[model samples]
Target: MFAPRVALASLSGESDADWAKACEHPAGAAFLGGVALDEPTREAARAMVDRDRDEFLPEDPVEFVDDQLSALDDAFLRAGVNVRTVDLDPLREVTEVCASHDAVLEVNAHCRQDEMCAAGAGESLLRDTARLCEQVETASDAGAAISVKVRAELPDVHLPTLAQAVERAGADAIHVDAMDSRRVVRDVSDATDLFVVANNGVRTREDVFEYLSYGADAVSVGRPSRDPEKVRAVYAAVKEWFL
Candidate 1:
């Protein structure tokens, strides 16, 4: 019921003010993402974000990440950010935890973090299809809108299979990371049936519109603060740009 025409460029670290701004895009209906994970610099990052939005610590992602992700999901949803959840084993813990908090869950296969992948998360899902599908069904059964975040690189990445599998898994949407290129989007279109929420490297309204041209349901903001003063400025400009 939100911006079927426009969406924001979302990422790991975002603010409620960011969500407020992204939604103001006359074209934007809602935002995606549940703030950033506990990065290597949690304290420093925490200071940069609004106190209410989820922020993580600087350490090897431990089981503690599961609770952090759950807490973030709950916090953002209450703040009205349409928070999307991510965790180590989206199948093992994130799905249920997100559902408990009434938040959306995504299988984050697009994470490029080396430490994440080494721990059997992130892009690791792309390696074993059999396991991935099982996990997809698991998340889908939990009542969370399942999504798969991928680079949308073809030949190099099996986005089509991943997309179909995600759909079969009962996902409500697919979050495509286009890496600032339209070709990447075409690849995702070829794979899934669910609506698209385009992401990654978006710096302008034109890029947002470009995704709309390809049937993307919405876009996410990569770097806009939820600060009251600046957030609305960016949202207002984008609103005018698309309308």
Candidate 2:
């Protein structure tokens, strides 16, 4: 009910117990952290389900989103969690799958990972506004609130224009990954009208203040390593600040 929501991206694992630990944090409403598809074995996924480390289920881009949603349904109760996924061509497959599970759908334009970009998801969408609008319209038309997850642009791009276009294209929210302070950093105030959700390169209570100061409706995070308490704290903070 906060102005913005806090969610975790790319969560994965082979064990329900591993997933239970992450669910323990109330702020982690949506979990997406996972290991590479080429390595979804229990041994590799243990970091995600057990240690709460960032891991993805080894899967093709679209399949990865499906796999995560499937695992979430099998791993947790629907009433307790609003699950979701991120992948390439999610409009082609993953979104339908999410609707079936009554899960939320997210388009990750923030992943700067080389392997992910090559797959044609994440930040690559930013490079092609035409495709970006297509993806947003596709998901939005499906009765889903398309969340455009993007990182701060390279020093050369127009940040405000990019943020505005996402909203103009029917995106319900804008996810700004502020991991590279030197490169991709967003001032929450820059996003007008759009629900600006801060993400990435964030691991502390103070880091969250940066978002609120800039008028971010909410913030998302995955740095469980920085502090096991961080996820819970963020969730509580968003509700406290906005709701």
Best by TM-score: 2
Per-residue lDDT for 44-161 in model 1, tens only? Answer: 2454355444444334332343444444452322212222123324344545655665545556566555444554445666776655666667777866556666665535566767
TM-score of 1: 0.64
Per-candidate clash tally: 15, 16
By summed lDDT, the worst window of 10 consecutive residues in model 1 runs over 76-85
Give the TM-score of each candidate: 0.64, 0.68
Clashes of 2: 16
Q: lDDT for every model? A: 0.52, 0.54
The residue-level lDDT of candidate 1 at 74 comes to 26
Candidate 2, residue 201: Cα displacement in angstroms equals 3.7
Please estimate how well model 2 matches the true structure, expressed as its whole-model Cα lDDT.
0.54
